[model samples]
Target: DGQKVTVIATDYTCIGEPVEINVIVSDLPNAFTPGSDGFNDIFGAGAELTIFNRWGQVIYEGTEGWDGKYKGKKVSPGTYYYILSVFDANNTKTTMKGSVTVVSDEK
Candidate 1:
């Protein structure tokens, strides 16, 4: 969703023109490669992210990012479900659920 914010300044006898700002929230990537080549090595969406495997088991949870690992081991390349929670500028929390695929460039 797109939201707009307006700001204005006023004094005892004067008022400045109002300014409009657009707030745009970006969507997380559908996939990432944890190969550590400095590109797409970590996946994250918000301040908190919880990822689960297809079997409904929690695989990863943290604020930092997921390196496609579980229990310090790299998970197989595949799709994983995730729940992301984030706070906006006003500290309003929003939660999102989606899937993200883990990719590997290694042979």
Candidate 2:
């Protein structure tokens, strides 16, 4: 934990900022509401997420993040697969794979 570091450099011609690289899996809910209730919302930015159905069909392709909707319609509750590729300020990429369950408890 906390094993990441940021480095900054500068020169007489220009000033440089620290490089930010964080592609770790966030502790997010297995399911979330796409209604924008100001809670568990979109995934982390600076990443490309290719979410797939159980049949291995691509359902959503998000370059920044996902809002639990595919083609402007809320998806149904089910188990889904995802392949997340995160990019840092330095253009370095990190990939991750996991599954999430979508559920709703509303009328």
Candidate 3:
């Protein structure tokens, strides 16, 4: 799981005072092996995960994470795109986008 974040603004009165908002995208592990032994059953990063198909259609979206399945069925091994959004304690949002590959057990 990713770390929890916090943000605080000292001066809320100042409009466009150049508030320094830091956005950091942690490099999560690119791949996970979700075996059927009840360990690592979910194959996704801990942050908010959004998966898009090759045609740019969002296939899955959730906060608990992706379990390498869609609509209660396992997805075939292939490449997919993911967008992870992390929010700080002060409600600052940071989003990270990347790609990942899912491999079958035989491979």
Indicate the residue-level lDDT of 82 in model 2.
Answer: 87
lDDT of each: 0.85, 0.70, 0.70
Tell me the number of clashing residue pairs for each predicted model: 0, 0, 0
Superposed by TM-score, candidate 3 places the C-alpha of residue 81 at a distance from the truth, in angstroms, of: 0.2
| Per-residue lDDT of model 2, residues 1-49, tens digit only | 1135677889999989988555455564566555557765665344678
Candidate 3 residue lDDT tens string, 1-107: 33444554555676443343444557665665545756555645456889987778888898877877878777777788899888765677788888877666544
Q: State which candidate has the highest TM-score.
A: 1
Candidate 3's C-alpha lDDT? 0.70
Q: In model 3, what are the clashing residue pairs, if there are any? A: none
**What's every prediction's RMSD, in angstroms?**
5.2, 7.2, 6.5
- Candidate 1's TM-score reads 0.77
The 10-residue segment with the lowest total lDDT in model 2:
20-29
Cα-lDDT of candidate 1: 0.85
Candidate 2 C-alpha error for residue 13, in Å: 36
